[model samples]
Target chain A: MTIKILGTGCPKCKQTVDIVNKAVAKLGADIKVEKVEDIIKIMEYNVISTPVVVVDESVKIKGRVPTMSEITALIQAS
Target chain B: MFDWLIYFSDWLIYDVSGLSEGSRLGTALSFFVYDVIKILILLFLISFIMGIVNVYFPVEKLRNYLNSRKLYGLEYLFSAIFGAITPFCSCSSVPLFIGFVQGGIPLGVTFSFLITSPLVNEIALALFLGMFGWKVTLIYAITGILLGTFGGFILGKLDLKDWLTDWVKDIMAKTYEKGDTVTADSINFIKELPLISREAWHIVKGVLLYIIIGIGIGAAMHGYVPENFFEQYLGGGQWWTVPAAVIIAVPMYANAAAIVPVIQVLVVKGVPLGTAIAFMMSTVGLSLPEATLLKKVMTFKLISVFFLVVTVFIVASGYLFNLVL
Candidate 1:
């Protein structure tokens, strides 16, 4: 599964990626995480608020940083 | 071809031409000009964008939504969103805050807007992405919004009705921009172009001064300051440094966009990212002007809460960055 962060590379978006990686590593799960910083492509996701988290092409979280445990739960539910 | 000319000249004087110690004076002069030009451009660009954001964005609508409390975290979320787009310096946001309060907006929600406005913005976002890459930028944005939301909510719960200044209360009772739609106000594109140009010009006119001020200070720090002093003293080792830095920074404001480059320089000189970030938050997010302006509307007690909320957020963010980033 792929986890993509959508935003024009602000600090919050960067933290989300870091937290996600840690969560994924903690779970011993192999998932690809990408930081998408291009504004035009981020707009395509129909996201106005930034630091959006997209898992498998569907946005899972928008405008908020999810906790590591919350992210682990999200990945498991997916 | 044009780019190569400037590059070649710079190389020739600094590297190739290799004038002995006698020509060091000339090289230093040229270097000063270069730094001055860069700072000027940055200030001009940021100020221009500020004007556009002020003129264009439908902020009153957003203010209304935040005031209405239509969603649980929605106001906080939107406050973050709008905050990013409109890059107002800490002092500049005070007038807007007064406007928001007078529009019947809740103080807590307005506080959220105030908190996020300085910490996260388009220019800073772009600068962070360009300098530190995507990961660092994302973390700053998310944490900034969270702080704003939490701070706003806490202030809302406090309900300090008596804390407001009498003049501000009077201003709140008076209506100024009634029934005026943000977009409905027609600007004469032809005449306004010059006016916009003039505003842009005036904004840029002081660029040389700001650049001189920013770089004179930055270069001295670059040249004179010990490389590991910040890291060893405040960032990595000292537990109290985070809160201290936040407290120290609130009274001294500098635009985040301008400060990022300085932070980048600091980090290069071995300053810890956490400490640098705390300083950045303080300098941009809280300043003497903002506190003085807030005094116009809020009593000392309310101002105390406001400072407490922001200072805590800055400290938390610094520690969070230390742990995560």
Candidate 2:
């Protein structure tokens, strides 16, 4: 599964990247995590806020950093 | 409402710490303790409530709503009000600004959101309510909303579309003219409580240091500064003080949480209430970093014009406040 994180490189966005990585590692999931920082690409997602976590091109989180457990639950569900 | 906090502060300072009542150090510490506790409690509660509201009324939904209809100039007011409730870090403002413009929201309406987002928010509201009471808080809130509304209206009327950088103009040309439908996920309130609480606590954690520093400065001024210390310079009669305060504040940047408590002390130390409010508004609303970020989409001319318009409104509000309050 591919998880794309979209943001404009703000601190929260960077932190979201770290948390998502840790969540993936903790869950022992072989997920491909990608960070999308380009504004034009981010706009394609139709979200005004960031950092957004997209699982298979579907938005799961936007505008806030998700906690570890929440990320795990999301990964598990997906 | 917080008499118990006052009593506890008094006991802690006088009985526990053995500081004599009414002494400078004693008074300062006591004031600090009382204000810190009161403001913290208020911040947590208000943020929690606002978090719930945000969960229900998501920003994407609001953006779509704004984009779908023309509010007959009430859009400016709605934008300003929307900006007040939706919180995001100022660093992320560029993307959001671009998104609004790309979504076909008017540049002027987006300006309203940008102007008031930082100047007035739940943290500022809670701090103001805790320190200045409801009357001042209500006046401040109303004035902030009006400042954004009128400032944005004037900017919108100017038709500064050509002033945008070519990059933004390019995007504007290509993108569709309205916001797309945003699907909001449905979750029961009980199931969302943890997320809401986390968000609220996250906000509180983010601003806790600013609150402390702000209230610490306030306490120091409260205890040690002689009466009329700032009155000599920023007194109500001085016509230049209002504009001067706004100008001085424009370049410096601090969140409203840090500035509000200090503003409370400034008013107490004989700075005119209007002048202090102007300073707070300018400091939070306009900043060098934000200007730098806007350089992405706006030319230097547009940025300067944006700053000048907002500054004038803030200065005018300062004078109006001085006259009325």
Clash pairs (backbone) in predicted model 2: none
Candidate topping lDDT: 2
Q: What's the TM-score of every candidate structure?
A: 0.64, 0.93
Q: Stretches of candidate 1 above 4 Å error?
A: A1-78, B1-12, B15-39, B64-69, B87-95, B121-142, B166-183, B186-194, B220-229, B254-262
TM-score of chain B of each: 0.76, 0.93
How far off is residue B197 in model 1, in Å? Answer: 4.5
Per-model TM-score (chain A alone) = 0.93, 0.97
Give the alpha-carbon lDDT of every model.
Answer: 0.66, 0.84
User: Which CAPRI level is candidate 1?
Assistant: incorrect
lDDT of 2 by residue, B172-231 (tens): 888565544443557689988998888788778888999999888877677778888988
A74 Cα displacement, candidate 1 (Å): 60
lDDT of each residue in B1-325, candidate 1, tens digit only? 1254446546756676565433645455445545555445554565566656555554655665666666765776677667766645343344456657766777777888888887786455555664566687787777777878888878878887668877667766776444234244675556445434544455455334544555556655666678766666555556787777677666556444456656776787766688777877777677677676567568888888888878887888788777776
Question: Which 10-residue window of candidate 2 chain B scores lowest in summed lDDT?
Answer: B176-185
